[model samples]
Target: MRPNARFTDVQPIGLDAVAAAAGTDPDVLRLENLDTDVPPPPAAVAATTQALASGEGNSWLPLTGLPVLCEAVAGELRSRTGLDYDPSRQVVITSGGTSAVMPVLLATTEPGETVALTDPTYAGLLQRVRLSGARPHFLPLRVEGGHWRLDRDALTQVTTAAALLLMSPSMPSGVLLDRDDWAAVAETCARTGAYLIYDAAMERLVYDGHPRINPCQVEGLAERTITIGSVSKEYRMIGWRIGWIAGPVDLMDRIRMAVIYNTTVSSGFAQLGAAAALTDPSGSGVDEAAAEYQRRHDTVIDQLAGLPVVRAAGGWSCLVNATALGLTAPELSSRLLRYGRVAATPMTAWGGTIAPDYVRLVYSREPVERLSDLRYRFDTALTSG
Candidate 1:
């Protein structure tokens, strides 16, 4: 049976794939979305509701995006990142962070041009890069005490003439890139003339009292940097299908072309909701959610950190080295699902070099009180096997 080439080699994402490989309970307790357990701001919801009630919610938006949302986005960027982005010229609202990546790829790279991404990165990023028909050069991240390290030499070598896709407070590992790492990456990209694509999806999810460092904040990199951000993680609006991109004007124009040609327009009313989110994030319904996630981070990391089997990394999750217990991550994940009623992602999904032996446990969506039970389950699964 020949599978369609487009998806032949891609790993299946269904539940059956979990059962077939792990021989554990197929039903997974999903906590991977990192979605806020809170609702959107009343102002945003009310605005959207009003738009819906008015019966004008069904309309195509502009290719360059809604002017109101774009201006709001510019204001937010100026406030948050201190970058003066012309919303009209530099911002394009898309379906989500997922949609934002493709257009950037379309705008920047020619076919066969390489994309350099960090290893143990966000899994979906690899798929997007591949979908764009570009080669992904994975730069392996060195895990130090509670953080992930970038190999500057490896980064420089791979980044020569390659587009760089970097995620801050990266997925799974949750290791936030510090100032020095950002500097090296910026310098490397500048030297190589590569486009720096910063995925700040989980930028706001940084824990342990770490300050948020926008990679675009680095000097001289803003002109060449393409920033993709989402309201999903920060504003509790994943269902809104509203995300945005900010970059150099010329590149942004090209991305708008790609967006218009493909999806045409995202929901007009949803853009309004997202605009509201951008304008008043602290006042948005996410402050409580961020507080909750912060609590979960503290609870999970403190519990898992003392365990010899796991090392706590900053972000929304903890990365456990499963090989230390003589079992692969998939095997342990399967067993945990069945016996412990838990589920975790195998790190290989993110191109981690030692993925088979490591699992990423997302803590954000889980209730803080249940973290104790999760820790116990993990202990049983890892030690028993």
Candidate 2:
């Protein structure tokens, strides 16, 4: 947000800047994107192939979603939360998870309403809040005991929100909300009549045997919970760009209309592919992907052991405290790119709570072998004088 309403300038996202600077350099260790090199599930690929040949998902009639795909998402949620959502009236498809978020924001909040979100959240999500004309109230995450935690004090502020837009394994910081944290949020929402809008794109990408509890599982939260998920992060189907929004049937009507108005509908074949991935009893390969990502995460943290890197319990990236290292985030990022050939993003405008010296290093895109030399690169970069 601007310092004042009179100030209309908006901050540029750090990811795009790093991406443009990194370019197509084969030698530059590309740690600037949330992308994963892991391929999509075999079942999804096969289904997309079949859809292309037979044209099953080629229609524009059902803008909400394909009946099969909606059921698949409903079943997926049911398995995770043990709460049932009617596929027919509770799910709507979108061009992508990013696309789905805007409509959800639109549905849950109004112009000038407060939307509670974590500090250091996804830049895209923060931007969408501004686009939807809602004011953002950030609940800061603290790095305590070398791991990220939702500052228990921030939970009190949820009462002032029209909705709480959050993600477990939150991007950039990799802060995962545990059972107690979620219980507090659920209780607050129930007490204050605030909506719980969950961004579940990377819900399955946990590390080190951590337990992930859905907000729906927290007593009385199911009816107030709105989940937005996609195949992008967990399913490795970024190109497919398929996502869904599910919630109470009455709220779902407004959400469906918002999505329909905003994106018209998601791609037909991609929806079929996502359906196939979600329904495959064999699974969607998320566990294998998370394992690979954990290895990469470990290597980077290990290499930067003496540095100011915070451990990411889950998700694809972690933060480095540039201020503690005696440098601003952009300056550190520039040094890494120039001297170390490493592309890392500065967390400048992601949220108000991110300090001026925070830089994000993405581990999902690169292999562990390539990341083994992280220390050498960092030492070379930081000690360059």
- The top-ranked prediction according to lDDT is 2
lDDT of 2 by residue, 99-156 (tens): 8988888888978898888888888888788878888888888889889898767777
TM-score of each: 0.90, 0.96
Give one digit per residue, the lDDT tens place, for model 1 in 51-113: 778865467757657898889888878876888898888988888887888888888887668
Q: State the lDDT at 333 in candidate 1.
A: 67
Error of 1 at 199 (Å): 1.2
* Model 1 bad stretches (over 4 Å): 1-9, 12-29, 285-287, 306-314, 383-385
For model 2 the local lDDT of residue 13 reads 81
Model 2: per-residue Cα lDDT at residue 31: 89
Look at candidate 1 and tell me the lDDT of residue 215: 80
Predictions: Cα RMSD each: 3.1, 2.2
